[model samples]
Target: MAPRHHEAIIVGAGFAGIGAAIQLKRMGIEDFVILEREDDLGGTWYVNHYPGLAVDVPTTTYSYFFEPNPNWSRLFSTGTEIKQYADDVADKYDVRRHIRFNTDVEGAHWDEEAALWRVALGGGQQLSTRFLFTATGFLSQPHTPDIPGIGDFEGTVVHTTDWADDFVADGRRIAIIGTGATAVQLIPELARTAADLTVYQRTPIWVVPKVDLKFGPRIRTLFDRIPLTQRAVRAVTDAIYAFMVDTAVLKHRYFRRFNIAAADLAKLHRFASIRDPELRRKLTPDYDFGCKRPTFSNSYYRTFTKPHVHLQADGIERVEPDGIVNADGSKTVIDTLVLATGFDLWEANFPAIEVIGREGRNLGKWWRETRFQAYQGVSMPYFPNYLSLASPYAFLGLNFFNTMEYQMHLMDRLFGEVRRRNATTFEVTEQANARYLDRMTEALGDSLFTLGNCASARSYYFNPAGEATLLRPMTTRRAVTEASQFPLSDYTFA
Candidate 1:
């Protein structure tokens, strides 16, 4: 057994990790360690450095409840600005002291006899903790496409997540693979600098106008002076977005109207800006609006109008000696290639870790064939004194941080009860978890996400049995209400 110990151990230093640490402090749980794989605290923001990368969500709703940025420069800050925000949050909360940078949590196993988690790190570092919190995000792992001859290509290749600083695209032909969210943001920025840019498209995404703007001096002063003004504004914005999604899409007969409006806007935007009819059709999305992710951008359509930028709709056949080859036997030679393929949102990410609960069964073995199942998206049946923030099916509609606040309150009350009752652990019943998973599957079947209009053939939302196990069908408000109050009777405390 390798040697450090603490009351609690968090596996990441991102929003979820830091947030959990803050919650622990408030609960009077002082002994904790936060382990981050990278040498920084921003998590996903710290890694992805492609040009023009920014938050599609408005700034007003993305901030934490404890701190709000009164002087946000833009409605949607760029990647660098967002990274700076993460740093500021760390500094403000004094959370840096609790973090161990460049240390990866290699594996974690439960010591059944001791009723503690045995955490292991790379290079033989080990620790035992009463509770384990996994803040490792769902989207951090980049899904590198298994294309033929990708490794054989002679050109400079990079992923959008790990962009090199010294890499220059000036006066050189650059090939960009996958026209997903990252590609939409980076394409416009590359079009301005690269001598020639070729974007290989697998499928077109539904593009929406981004209502982005800088906060004026007046608004900043109002937030700084009134203080509560910013909070009120954030609350209102969150409510509006929540209501709009619920009334229009969640359970509505008029949901198709919203889709029609979005489609019409895309058509109008495509025809008005792009002159080539052939290019227009290639850019037009065949999938239903909101079926897949809806990208928001102002310049994505206009970028295609530039003479230096080209979009290849034909599927990529293989990577040639220097560049990408199309299915029609056409080849485009370029100096550099970038893959923005996306992330691995598979359900087996956690099960890949060897976590043994109270019983002798390994978590990986239990979830080997089935998808991930959790009660209220936070608790597993066998795992006691353990919780996961932003777990599968728990991603909030408006702000994830807001949902986290609710979860923190719930855990605080549960732990308080544990202390009061002189209990060592709290474990959910297997029947409850099974029931929740059944409801989750039934709800997703009727939701817009399960519709066959997604751009990709395969989805990250389902299991091998085609059950929707990764997403929650409940509204943000309802989820918080149900999860905020943890019932003691549901678990067998010891």
Candidate 2:
């Protein structure tokens, strides 16, 4: 029997996929299906429900620009609220019907003769689509550190990505590995109830104070009644974050003082929260503030000052059945182990699933062998009719909505041209892709990742090649402008 087909197949029903679906519908191209691996559609929000999970980015700037939710309960909304926002946006845009939950896309190959993509699914099912989009986010794959004897451990082990609802941490001896953004949030929550909490930190993170204000009824009413009021708030929030990204990361050499000031703010926060000088020293990050992704929390720093909490910076030697052995030869027995090791960004998640483009050019293998890149962080050479929403240099600032909004503009422009020419296939020109990669490489030289000290930071921004290719080295305005105004000649349509 012939397999099911659609005009477009979007892998991953996350926000990015939903955005893409909305864009397609707006373009009068509605014959598409969103394939989601999970049973739900919230992507990271749906997948991650760890304790104390909340938006690190401000609620005003974190949501979709087109569909802003004025009813956020807090300045930094919780994971449940974010998931509900996703659902609301999906429903409002009428894209929910197009989504196929629990549908896993194993691989996809470009069919030259058929001029379409053949997507392979987990249960031996195949689907064909004229255009293929991979919206599997950067943080889609959860990374488990290869600690010795982790497999032989007798206790319950939980990765932050797969947190169990019934797993109780109250009064239980617990050890958590990693100090990334996720760990920063989880640690404080665990510290509150755990009888004994041990945090195994490889590198300390820079934390700033989170100004999380609960929204009052009046504020919500003001936002709902006067939509422009919410827009103004969003603009202000966007500007503040954009200033941080510009001065601290994008143009660190010219504005190093800003970076220093930000670091000092974190230091002041740390000093105020923790009383012990030794503990403060252990908690402080040695690297520059913008080197790694910084987070904001009111209670994270103070959580370490608790009597029962311990900070283990000596590194992990191995994990035994009962507990973990530190590199200093000390051991701590724990009943539950939590791994907040973050995601495998470059290795397992660049192209989350196998993608074989024209002439058997594998996307993942090509990126690793050569260099990680994508033209305008969307289109790639030899990948005809394909768009990768989570490609390299796509992320803009701390908020993902900035990137998504600009990419939506790019989609509008690119697909508008495709419709103008009445073309069935389109691919970015090799010269164009190469030129864009060169421009990105040159521009990154002035950025914090290149000029700033990041040796001890262990940032996910830097790919395995030691290149900070994750964020585009330009302002959000320029990104949107370029995305909308890039030359149509850059892509060949047929």
Candidate 3:
């Protein structure tokens, strides 16, 4: 029997995938299916249920423009609230009806002769589609460090993304590894309940105070009643974040002093908990502020002041059933081990599903050889009718909603072009891809995120080729504007 098919198959139900499905419906393209590995609709939010899990940006500007939520409990919504918003949006748009949850895409093969994407699903299921979109986010896959003898540990082991519900840390010794964004949030939560906590840090990170506030009933009522008032607040919040964090601290040269000054303030923030001068120095990062992803937390620093907390700067040597051994030969016994090591980056974190393109070529082969280049991060060469959300040098500013919305507009234009040409395939020309990357490379050389102290920090922005290819490297406005425009001649149709 022939397998089921659809006009398009979207491999995610997160913000990007949901946006694609909605836009497809809006464009009068109804025959589409969304494949989600998880049972729930929310992608990252669905997987991650750790304590103190919240978005870094303010909720006012952090959500979808098409469907804004005025009743956010806090300026920075918690993971629970974000997941609820995603669910609400899905319900409002009738998106869940088209979604196949628990359906993992094992692989994708492009049939050049048939002009269709043949995707392999688990349980020997197969489906074909005219187009395929991957929205698997970078941070969706939790990364556990490779410590020798890790399996020998008898205690409960957990990652922030896969936290066990019934595992209580109260009256238990807990040791957490890694100090990235997840650890910064999880440390404070564990410190409150655990009898003793030992944190294993590979490197130092700079942290600033989080600006979070609860919206009172009166404020929420005003926002709900006067929609324009909510819009005004969102605009103001977007402008502040765009200028203060992206433009002033990370992008523009003239305002770089703000970055340096902010680092000094972080040092002061650490001094509040760490009174010892040497310990304070240990907390300060040796590299520049923006080298690695900056975190916002008020409790992270203060949690260290607890008498039972131990911060280990040394690396891990091995793990035993009874305890963890440090590089310095010191051992600490714990009841639970939480891996806050963050995710494998960019190319390393690419979707595990196999993707075969033109002439029987696969995405892993082409992308590995070229080191992740594409036309505006959406369309790739030789990959006809294929588009993705988080591609090399295609990601825009901090606001993820804005980034997805910008890409959706670009996708609309490309799909329209396909309709106009009456073509089954649309792949970027090699010359066009090179030209775009050439100009992008030159622009990236000037950005502090790339040309500055990021090299010393071993940031995920840099790919396996030792090039910073994850970021778009342009101002948010310019990047989004450029993403929308495409010379039809740049793509070849058949």
Candidate 4:
């Protein structure tokens, strides 16, 4: 028998899930259950434990707005530290008492008769709720490269998303598969310890030098002692970062010059740092800077200069008994394999969970039919009272947490409306959703995805139609402002 009833059911315990729970609690919505698959919290942070795993965005900018951690150890924080911070947030909010840890949400279907969502758990426990919130963020799942011989590889293999602490690569011959953002930050760190490192690169990446600096003792003490000073400092830093990616990336004079400087800096760093021109060429990318998520690495370029490190630009053909074989028939032997390939950002990493909305409509099929359109990336038309925290176009290159906070704010308003109207459900109208979807698609088409410059084969930013879905092309402020205004007029009340 399913544990039968609650006012709300939240699926994940990550940044987004926790955000929703905290906001709901503040709004006096206490009858809610946060279902976490793992025994602990920190959704993405808990999973990705690879070497040199850390936040790419600056520490001052990437945290919660309401409660900023003034005591971060570095400008760019590591995975462990961030995870601990998430755990801290959970503790501070007393959110753990409401969370059902180690409980995996199997599936959820809307029961038309009761007008509630029936949520199934792995342990055969069930919960019924008036609304379902999928805070299981878009990037929670690990995507493995579909190479033929992946299973046959005899050496120790690991994915950056599921890295185990017990695993070691200290003196082992390691071959890293993907050269995405994770690879950029980690390769350099691995070089300092690995016996021999070979990076199999399918495409070249535009490498930019990270100007990471540690805060002085005075600044740290000041920020810790005076909270307002920390908030002011964080605000200033956030604005500067927003300008760089949001406005600066689009500007002709400033951003273009910035790209040239980036390339030149890479060349200078490589020239002074790496002696091998061929290796440098393989490491350098041809696309415009910020064409993809620009990685932060001060030592990645320097890593190539190491005697034991090898960068193979040739495409991976297949996995041999010892290591990877390139398209050009060249092979490098390694005892350990690390896949730095990122997650399926579009699928929202909750594919295993079956979500059946009105008339038994599956969420996946609905997305597929509509090309992944959601009104402000939150509530879909048929799926009433459903909100995805970091859904389509909710991603801002500046800092993901700010976007998450904004979405949480939007959810707050929606829940408020639900309470005010004495309504059990509020579904987005199809006409409004379609109109917004068209506008968003037009906006994206004018942006970088269709700009003929981005060169990756496929990324999680797109829908099933190969159209970009995860990001809105507008500025961060505009996106947030637009998301904040929910058209109660567009929602039908019951």
Candidate 5:
């Protein structure tokens, strides 16, 4: 049978895919399909429903600039609320009709002669399109630690991504691995109900106080009535976070004082919450601030003060059917083993799926063999008419919406040019990509990951090659301006 065809094929139906769809529609490109692996939309928000799940970033700055949700229940909205927001956006924008749930894209390749991309789906189906956009989020793939006995004696083993609805933690002894952002949220909730809770800490995270506030009916009504009021609030929150990212992470060498202040704030929060000095020391992060992603929570530190809760800094020696054995020959017997170990960002999730471009250049293989790069964090050299939303140097600030907004601007500019030229295909030139890569490299030289003491930080920011390519080293303002004003000659449209 002949392959189905469209003007564009979008992989993943998350916020990135949704934003891309909205942009395409604005460009008058309506014949596109969003292929989602899950049965529902919301991507990460849909996949993860673990306990204590909420946005660490404030809700005001976490949403699309144009589609602000004035009805957010709290400053840090719950995962369920975020998912609902995504659904509402889709419905409002009329993008839900373009989405195909439970459609898995296994691979895709460029057909040079045909001047189209042939996407291979599971179950041997194929789809062709003029453009392909992979919006599979950075943290889509979960990582399970390769412990020796994890597979054998696991009793009700659950990863955060695949949490079962009926799984109960009440009075059950639990051992959870990883102390990342997700674990920080989950540990406090489990401590409340578990008979015994042990957190296996591979690396301690920097956590500050979360000033989350519940919005009353009055505020919601005001926001709905006067949208500018909500925009003002968003602007304030955005400025504060932007300052933190610009000073602490991007310009660490010159603005080291801001990083020190942030570390002091976290330390003060820890000191006030945890009573035991030893436990406080154990929980303290050794690396510099902004090395890894930081989270905010009011209950996480205090949860450790509970008598039944234990923090095991000793590495995992192995796992037995009954419990986990510590490196110092200690054992913790538990009924439920939770793996909060975060996503596999570098190895498995760079491309997420197979992508073959011009001259048989494999996206994953090329990135691994050389370095991870993309022109303006969207376009690649050999990948014609393709955009990767989760590419390196794409993430701008603490808030992902900032990145998305800028990328949307980029798409608008790029697609506008294509429409102006009446071009059917577009590819970023190799020279332009190289120049952008060099500029990114030079800009990142001033970042905390490069200058600060991040050797001890097992940060996902640094890839296997020891380069911190995760974040773009620029202010959000600059990112937006560049996205809108990039040279048209950088991409060859034909």
Candidate 6:
């Protein structure tokens, strides 16, 4: 069949994808298309509609650096508000027209002869492009635990990523599994309405108290009228968070007091909120805060104080027809079962859409047989003219917006190199990819993820080899600078 073609093809219309498109337009490259699997613009936000769903990061730091939202209703935005921001940005930049919604990519193969990516779409459609950018985020894929009787759960089962607007839980006996970020955000909301809410937590997580406030009209008016004033607030917020990440989360030594203090604060909050000593112990994390993803919630600890809410530490052994069997043989009848269990981070590397690199180098096979590593966490050694955003070890701390910015900077540079050389293809050399991974691996060996009291957090942060793979192991500032200084000579373009 004759296939459609473009100068550039991007997958996933989230922050990474939208940023890449905007940058490409700015560089006078408009022959591009953004393919989104969902029928909407927002990527993660559009998918998740769970109760109490809101961004953990502050609005000041979460927004795009170029398009700061001076009109955020709250300090941290709800999922609905955040999704609207994404839609607004797309409309403002006129990138929405380039987006083909509900177009799912099934596979992508690098065409050596044509120097183009042969992208196979769902429903027997196909496209070819000179450059293929995969912005399919790491957290897009949902993961339910491998429990024996989960399928036979005769009650209402809901995954956080697939929550429906019409699904109701009020006055129902709810059993929610997992105590990660998603679960943490959900418990407080469920406690308020559910007849009885039992949270089956396998592992406890460290929690920092969240301080949220409404952005009053006075501040909103000032921010919208005077852009510089809002810029100052955002800058100050950025500086404060950057320091917290560098001193506390990044390093395992040297004023390790910061990590300890943060943990102590969490413990104190738990102590103050939870009256029962045994219950507090069950809620406390044995590992350090930064081992797993650190979570912020003002009402999470306070929720347990309610008589309607229950916390189970032994976790769910199996699911009965209408109840969850705890490891200790206790069973709680649940009318509704919600799996707030988050996404499959590792599986995201394989791409729901398959990718075949040069010389029949299958992307999935390479990741499984060899380790998952990328040159500066963007380009692989074998994938010419391909850029993978939000790649392994690419997440800079917890600030996704900043991480995407750093990645886009690298992408902008690589696109520039492609234009300058008038090259048909570009990929990182094997040696360069290896060397960059080696340095990062060494530095990661000493970070809080490996050490710092997190021996058995069972965190998604570590891969099967017990090495940290999800985080970049550097401060946000440094990660951006490193991406900016990428040696153009490192890539082979021809």
- Best-fitting candidate, scored by lDDT: 5
Q: What TM-score, over all chains together, does every model reach?
A: 0.94, 0.99, 0.97, 0.93, 0.99, 0.97
How would you encode candidate 1's per-residue C-alpha lDDT over 1-494 as one tens digit per residue? 34677999988888888788888888888899898999999888899888888887777888787788887878888888778888888887778899999997777877878888988888987889988888877677777888999989888888998999887778889989888888999889888889999999887887877888888899899998998998997887778767645644454343657656767887887787778988888888776665556678889999998889988988889997788888989999988988988886664464424566767656656664456677777777778777766466666653567666667766777788888998988888887777778877777655666644654534455555565555567787677677666466767789
lDDT of candidate 2 at residue 199, scale 0 to 100: 94
Instruction: Report the error of model 5 at residue 187, Å.
Output: 0.5
Local distance difference test values of all predictions, in order: 0.77, 0.93, 0.82, 0.77, 0.93, 0.85
Candidate 5 residue lDDT tens string, 1-494: 88999999999999999999999998899999999999999999999999999998889999999999999999999999999999999999999999999998999999999999999999999999999999998899999999888997658899999999898899999999999999999999999889999999988999999999999999999999999999999999999999999988888889999999999999999999988999999999999988989999899999989999999998889899889989999888988999999999999889999999999999999999999999999888999999999999998888788888999999999999988999989999999999999999999889898899898888999889999988888999999999999999999999
Clash pairs, candidate 5, are: 153-321
Judged by whole-model lDDT over C-alpha atoms, candidate 3 comes out at 0.82
Whose TM-score is higher: candidate 2's or candidate 3's? 2
Clashes of each: 1, 0, 0, 4, 1, 0
Q: Which ten residues in a row have the lowest lDDT in candidate 6?
A: 344-353
lDDT of 4: 0.77
- What are the RMSDs of all candidates, in order? 2.2, 0.8, 1.5, 2.3, 0.8, 1.3
Kindly provide the TM-score of model 1 when superposed on the true structure, using C-alpha atoms: 0.94
In model 3, which range of ten residues has the least summed lDDT?
245-254
The C-alpha local distance difference test score for the whole of candidate 6 amounts to: 0.85
Clashes of 5: 1
Off by over 4 Å in 4: 248-272, 347-352
Candidate 2 or 4, higher lDDT? 2
Compare candidates 4 and 6 on lDDT and give the better one.
6
- lDDT of the structure predicted as candidate 1: 0.77
Q: lDDT per residue, candidate 2, 82-126, as tens digits?
A: 999999999999999998988888999999999999999999999
Model 2 alpha-carbon drift over 4 Å, by segment:
none
Kindly report which residue pairs in candidate 4 clash with one another. 3-126, 393-470, 393-471, 393-472
